[model samples]
Target chain A: MFIKIDFQSETPIYLQLRNQIIEGIAKGHFKPNDSLPSVRQLASDIGINLHTINKAYNLLKSENYIAIDRRKGATVLPLMDEPDMAFVDDLKKTLNTLIASSICKGISKDDFLTICSKIYDNFREEM
Target chain B: MFIKIDFQSETPIYLQLRNQIIEGIAKGHFKPNDSLPSVRQLASDIGINLHTINKAYNLLKSENYIAIDRRKGATVLPLMDEPDMAFVDDLKKTLNTLIASSICKGISKDDFLTICSKIYDNFREEM
Candidate 1:
């Protein structure tokens, strides 16, 4: 339930919040059906505007990472079983840029894959 | 030297242009020291403002992906030998979000690594 915000970053606060929440879920810090802090509580905890927290929640909801209800508030959703083609395409485009930059930096394919595997393994440790 | 612009994308035109150029380099469509179209020409070709193209070029220059000179216009820079920590950190963060989503989608480690290797090999074909 800890979200760190860097005010100096060029990235918007709401996007940062959303990313961290997603990362938190990936790290197993927030399991499926886990309740997130209410908008007022999170805003107070993070010392940010309530609307900013609301925006982040709405975005997460739109992406199917979480759901909000009038009686229960906001909670994490179980991971979707079906693959999202749109997300896969978007991920490939992003990976292309990172791979391009790594190539420019003289990083070999083996080394890059090693790094990716190592990072992925770190997440598995949490599970 | 063809750059396709998607007007409906949520991504900014300048950023899309920058990414496509980087991907072009990875795909060997543009090689080391290759000259890019002048800002005016590209702007006219893409039907966007000159300043947008200028912004993208400046960003590329700042990232060391390309260099701009008064006489030479803009040209791709040779790959750097040393790794950039800041860039690596940024890439790791992005990859984390991607890995998170992939895990949620039930993509296995082997599948993910296979995809990475295949994409890397595709880039190598250009060389």
Candidate 2:
């Protein structure tokens, strides 16, 4: 996968890399159990700092988005068997905050839901 | 409004203040053109640093969420005349990233949409 980093965005490079990798997972670019390129390889391939790629990978690992092996490096984790209660709580809090901002911006509830539905479907479960 | 600060959370205090005020607007606790407490007054009231409140208010100002006046201090702006295209674009990007993480966590699309619908309607338009 060609990871595009927006040099001009104010967002830190590691976070951009993190979000894109999560996006890649959602878009089925990296299937369950798929092996991601090694940190060194990805760094050289994209001209990003090795530290940046490592940070992104570590974040993904901590989030349970990926698992790292001693020798095998990084691999995508299978979807959780049950939805995590903690994760759901965090999701509600986040969505609530985002919806509040959207409401203040005059976005109708329907408009917000339409966007949510569209994005959810954009990540079709090809598993 | 009684503002609560969770120092334990990693979220910055300023952004938390910003989100709470936006939540206040959505919940109708703050009406259109409602005058917010002056920086000094709110800082004293909430026991937060004046600089933190100032940062939050300035951010709100930049987002068109509030207006600052020489005499009035700060006031909530009326809902946008029309949705800002840039804001909608940002909304899409943020939602896309969030929804991706949800999908990876075994959150079915239906479950995700239901959450969105619930949060959206939770902010009833009392205007």
Candidate 3:
């Protein structure tokens, strides 16, 4: 549930921060309405730039993952609204490419399902 | 499967081309050893830039999905080798973020698996 950033990773810093925060939510590290560290606090804690945390927070806000308030910094939102058709379509598109590649490499259907199950279960505590 | 391009889509063109080809292989539209059109020919057929087609083909080659030969141009490869740990790890990392986001949005494990099963079944022909 800790925020760890790999500066050398191919993924951009903001995305890394965003993903970890989301994962933290999924793993119940941060409950709904829990306060997140201010961007300045996180920047100092992680030794990352203030701009990077701001970007990540902004993205999370745009995606409805959090709300930015001047008094409370960023607050987690439950965000349990049903996904729209556009979300379903986008998820399908991404999974299509991933499944295609995995199939080409001979990942069995059962194996693929098992992997999905494992990852899905990893976030079960939150639900 | 037919290759269609949405120029208005936010996804880059070359990625679109590459994903479609991979989908083609997954759906049995292109079998092992099947000859894909040369980069130039595909560029002409799709009305895309030669560079875009070349980039897609190059990515396919690097991923072991196809082979490029001067004599035969590009040929579909079976690419049935079991994925290594690195590939599995990468898949886990991506799925983690996606699953986390979906969970935060109130998608259930059953719904998630059903969605995954639907997509994975889509490529059953190739397997």
Q: Model 1 off-target regions past 4 Å?
A: none
Question: Taking the tens digit of each residue's C-alpha lDDT, what string does model 2 give over A4-109?
Answer: 9999998889999999999888888898899999999999998977998999999999999999998899999987757899899999999999989998888988
Q: Provide the global lDDT of candidate 3 against the true structure.
A: 0.87
Q: Give the per-residue Cα lDDT of candidate 1 at A71.
A: 78
Q: Candidate 2, which segments miss by more than 4 Å at Cα?
A: A125-127, B125-127
What C-alpha lDDT, on a 0 to 100 scale, does residue B35 get in candidate 3? 95
On residues B44-65, what C-alpha lDDT tens digit does candidate 2 reach at each position?
8889889999999999999989
Number of clashes found in candidate 2: 0
Q: Which prediction has the highest lDDT against the true structure?
A: 2
List of chain A TM-scores, every candidate:
0.94, 0.92, 0.93
Q: Model 1 — TM-score against the truth?
A: 0.95
- In candidate 2, residue B18 scores what lDDT? 94
Work out the TM-score per prediction: 0.95, 0.95, 0.91
User: How far in Å is the alpha carbon of B96 misplaced in model 2?
Assistant: 0.6
- Candidate 1, position A22, lDDT: 84
Clashes of each: 0, 0, 0
The window of 10 residues in a row where model 3 chain A has the poorest summed lDDT is A79-88
TM-score of chain B of 3: 0.92
